[model samples]
Every structure is written in structure tokens, then in C-alpha cells.
Target: MIDLARQQLAHDADPLVVKVGTRCLTLPDGTLDECQVESIAEQLVRIGAGTTRRVVLVSSGAVGAGIGLLKLPERPTDLPSLQAAAAVGQCHLMESYNRAFQEHGLLAAQVLLTADDINDRRRYLNFRNAIRALFEYGAIPIVNENDTVRTAELSRTVGDNDQLAAMVTNALRAPLLVILTDVDGLYDGDPADESSQVIGMVEAIDESTTGFAVVGTHKSGPVLSKGGMLSKLQAASIATHAGESVILANGRSPNILVDLMAGEPLGTLIPGQGGRLAERKRWIGSAAMPIGALTLDAGAVEAVAERGKSLLPIGIKAITGIFDKGDLVSLIDEAGVEIARGLTNYDSSDLGKIMGQPSEAIADILGRAPYSVAVHRNDLALVRDAEGS
Candidate 1:
């Protein structure tokens, strides 16, 4: 179904977040494509020329560019090799973007981020302020993961550009997140098959919607990157859950950004699901990476999920991983589904001692109870609702 209202929401959205994948930024041989970069930069400049809407571009191609420069047979699998490639290619990547945007009479600001940037609350706010300042100066902010420093291949926090883009969208509260990839859109069947049809609109991203991602799993993206349709869908889920719309379309398509702004149904649209979350809650749900998990009992699950109660020590049945006090932790139900995430009052060792014990028993068990509750309701962010769970 084509809904003009939703399309209008995307069309009129200020501060649009656009994510361009490696396939769009790199040639088939994994070389950085300067012409493609220019074309994309031109389109962005055209879209932001007259409108007050601020455009932020999240790009992926450093490793691919390195591969081409090094004339590697394929993408490197080792962490050291990947890091070395990123270091070598990051300079080239920024140079291309700067050259491309400068031709359109615009300056491009390079922002490299890692998981620590999002995990730390102060740094997260700092990043937001920096982006705002860049917009004020009439410069386009181009963001990418700090692959040279981050071991994303080993542990995924700023996993890929897709996830990084989603986090940025949530952090900025951008109304629309446009993801540009190689595919036309999410298909109902195998993308390579002629019978597969591109879905026009998605109201929400659920298990059924994500199922479409696996339909054509065999035909993944080029060897330049590890991201695929599933990653894009995960990105969509993040943005949509934060009350932001997403448009996944092919970047190679002609006049795609301009046409999208004109309210043409050119891509698969996943509209925002509910009201936008507050800044703190958005950070908790979308940005904070859980260092540990607390498994809740049946009663605790019902109380937290339905009654909106805080997580008490008595509710916790098990704890996994070593984490310190004030660290972000996941709250999972009996079925191992994550219900919420919040800052914990006690460390993993202390929580282990106080598990299934009442608030009165914490002081007795741990010498002193710093906080009565394990995780206060104010600090907790529910990822799934009761019905959804």
C-alpha cells in the first residue's frame, strides 16, 4: 500500500540520516570509485541546497579501498590485516569525500567513532553537539567507524556501518534514515530470482519482516564488506523502534535522493512505530552496549514487563559475565529474550551474592546496600513490550 502521508513524513523530515554501503562506494574490484563518490555528493548537495533539512552521510569503504590499493586477492580475515588496511585506506577515503564535496561547493567533516563513543554518556552528548556545530557551519558531517582502532571483527559494538548509522540516527533523533545499498529493496523471495517482488511498505519490523532478509542469503554483498540485507534490516529495526522512518534503496539508481524527496515510492519504506523516546532512553535502548546480562524469574518478568516495576535483587535468578557497578546490563526474561537494559547498582560479584534475595538481605549479604533496587525504572529502557515479548 502506498501511503502519501508516510511518504510525506520522509520527504519533509529534517536532519535526514543517509547510510551508503561499501557496494555503492567501491568498484567491483574493491577500489574506491571517485566518480560514484562525486555523484553521491552531488545528489546530497542538491537535496540540501535550498531546504533547511540537515543531511548526515554514513559511509563504508575503507577496507575495500585498501584491498584495491594493496591489490589483495580478497578481503582480509585476520584482525591485524583488517586494521592495517583500514589505517591505510582511511586517508584515501576522506580525500575522495573532501574532493567530491568540494566540487559541489561544500565542506565535508570527517567523524570517526567507536563503541566507546556511544557507551560513554558524556561522549555521546559531545558527538551530538559536534554534529550540530558542523550543521551550523554549513558543512556536511560524514561519519564512519574507527576501524583502525576498533576491533569490530572480534567484538561488534560499532559492528558495521549499517549499525553505526542506526545509532547515529537514534542519537540525533533524525526523522528519516535512508540506507543506500546495492539491492533495489527488500524482496519477498530470492533477489536473484525474477519471481521475487520488492515489498513496497513495511509498517513494522517483526520476525516475519526479518524472514525476508534470509530469503536470499546465498547472494551476499561483494567481498569488500561483511554487511548484508539482514544487517540493513537490523538497522531499520533500530531506527524504526526509535520512532524514525527508514528508506532502503539502491544507491546506483539515478536521481534517487531527489526523487525520494519528491515523494516518489522508489524504495521500501519502514515508518516509525511509536512516539520518539527521550534522549536518555534512546541512548539506553540504541547506544548502550550491554556488558552483562541478568536473567529474571517469572514473577520478576511479569512485574517489570507489565507493572512497570524496577528491577529488584529478588527478581534476578542468574547473572552472566563480569561487570562493574554503573555498567550497562541486559534484563532478560525466562525465555532468554531481552526485555530491558539499565545501569546496574551492584557489581556482578555483589549481584551474584544478592540474587533471589530481598532488598533487606542485600545489606546483610554485601556488608552495605548502596542502593535498594538493582536497576531503577528511570534508568531502565524496555526494548520489547509485554505483548511483543
Candidate 2:
């Protein structure tokens, strides 16, 4: 069935973010597949043809290409060796993309970014401006993580191409984000079983949806990709919660991009929220990493998560990690699940003294009542509800 959301995206999605996994562009031997790269370039061009819509491509396979180029027996495990492979493979990957896009009379602009780049507000906006400039120049922006400098940034726990692509989609306010992988969207059962079928659309990401993410992976073994379906789903959750759509589809299929944009129901379609989040809130919820965490009592959790109230010291029961004033910290419920994140008004040391104390007792505990609230409602962003964790 054709969803109205997909149709709307086909007609109105101005700048699209498409993420292609490493496994889709590499062989079992970890070599760069030129033919696949060319096909991807061609499909990207076709998606923009006869329209003003532009595309930003998030591509993987640097380490794989490096392994093939250096003739390594297997994928590297150490940080130095992985970085070395990335340094070599980034050049080869760009060369292939440049040549492939040139065939269609389009310029491919390579943009390498690091986690710190996306984490800082100033650097993040600068990255967005650079992409906009490339659009004006009529060039397609091909983005990848700067693995050569900080391969740790690509670790699944910290972040990956999938998370990077979602961040780009939010930063650009792109209406759609299409994640292309090896498997055929998300499945109801094990993908290896013939009886399992692809789920057509997902309105919201919940525990049930996340349960499906544990089916492991297809096509890409551990040597090729560290990100599995869970990472992709988490990425999708990030985008969708920000009022942007996501399509998880198989890149190996012929003309997959073309078919998906045409509202052909090619993959699992996760629809967007009703309204977009404010820029500052978006950053707090998705971009910024927390330095510390505060565990709130049940009453505090209800007040903050359900009533849109500020976090008070009276509700805070436990604190973890060392952080200072204005630093980002996570708010955890009694169950240890993160309910929200925001900038704290006081440093960890100050907070430790006043936790569980009423607002009136702040001055007595800290010697100065500069502020009453632990986290202002204006600064806090509710995450658990949107992510449905």
C-alpha cells in the first residue's frame, strides 16, 4: 500500500539524506565495488532529475576499501591499524565516487566529519553551511566520518554512519532520510526464514519494533560492518522523533532509490512526528552527549516527563559522573532508564549537597541560592517518550 507520507515525501522532500552501508559497496574480500558505486551515483542523479530537490549521501566502506588496497589478511582490530586503513580507503572511496558522478555530469563533493564536529553547536552549523554552499554550486555532497583521525567515533557505542546520517537529516531539516542496507527492510521473523516478511510501515518506534532489531544482520559479516539493524533503528528513531521520515530498505535491489522515492512501498517506512522540535531542543535530545546523570524519584519523573515541569533538587535521589555548571546531564528515572537530558544549573559538587532538599533549602545547603531549579523546563528535553525505549 502506498502511504500518504511517502507520497508527500515524493512531492515535497527538498533535500534528502541517504545512507549506504559498507556491506552494500564491498565484496566478501573487502574490495571497493566500482560497479556498485557507479550504480549508486546514477540512482542519486535520477532522484534529483527534473526537480529542484537535492541529495546528501552518507557513504561507508573506508576501512573495507583500505583493507583491499593494503592487501591485509583481515580487518584490523587496533585503533592505529584501523585509522591507517581509513586514511588509505577514504581517498580510494572518494576517487570512485568522483568518477562515478562525473559520468552523469555532476560534481561529487567529499565532506569528512568527526564526532566533535557534530557535537559542538558552532561546528555543527558550519558543517551545514558547507553543504548548503555545495548545493548552490550544483554539486552532490558525499559525507563520511573522519575515521582516520578518530576511529573511536565510528564505534557503534559512540556513533556510526547511521547516527551521523540522522544528525545530518535533523540539521538540514530534510523531510526524508533513507537508510540503505543489505537486508530487505525490517522483518517480522528471522530474515533467514522464508516465512518471515518485511514490515511495510512503522508509525512509531516502540519496544516491539526494537525487539525485531535483535535478529542480527544479513550480507555484512562482523568484518564488514559493526552496525546492525539496532543501530539503524536507533538512527531512524532519532530522525522520526524530529519530524522527519525514514525508509529502511535493501540497497542491493535494482533501482531501489528510484523505486522508493516513487512511493512504491519498497521498504519499511517510518513516519515523522506531527511537529518539529526547536533547534536547541533538537540538539539537547539528539546531538549533545551527556557528561553526568541524575536519577529522579517517581514523582520527579512524572513531573518532568509527563507534566513538563523543571527538575528540582528535591526530586533528585542519586548522581553519577563528574560535571560542572551548564554541562549536559541525563535525567534517569527510578528504573535507570534515561527520561530526559538538559544543561544543569549547578555543578556536580553543588548538586551533591542539595539533592533531595527542597527548593527553599538550597541557600542553606550551598551558601548561596543562585538558582532554584536543577534543570529548567526550558532546557530539558523529553527523550524517553519520543524514542519509546
| Residues 15-97 of candidate 2: C-alpha lDDT, one tens digit per residue | 99999999889987889999999999999999899999989999999988999999998888888999899999999999999
Best by TM-score: 1
Candidate 2 residue spans exceeding 4 A from truth: 1-4, 151-158, 219-222
* Model 1 per-residue lDDT tens digits across residues 250-357: 899988887787778877998887889898988987786888999999998888878889999999999999999988999998889998889999999999999999
lDDT score at residue 292, model 2, on the 0-100 scale: 90
Please give each candidate's TM-score: 0.96, 0.94
Q: How much is the lDDT of residue 139 in candidate 1?
A: 94
In TM-score terms, candidate 1 sits at 0.96
Cα RMSD (angstroms) for every candidate in the order listed? 1.9, 2.1
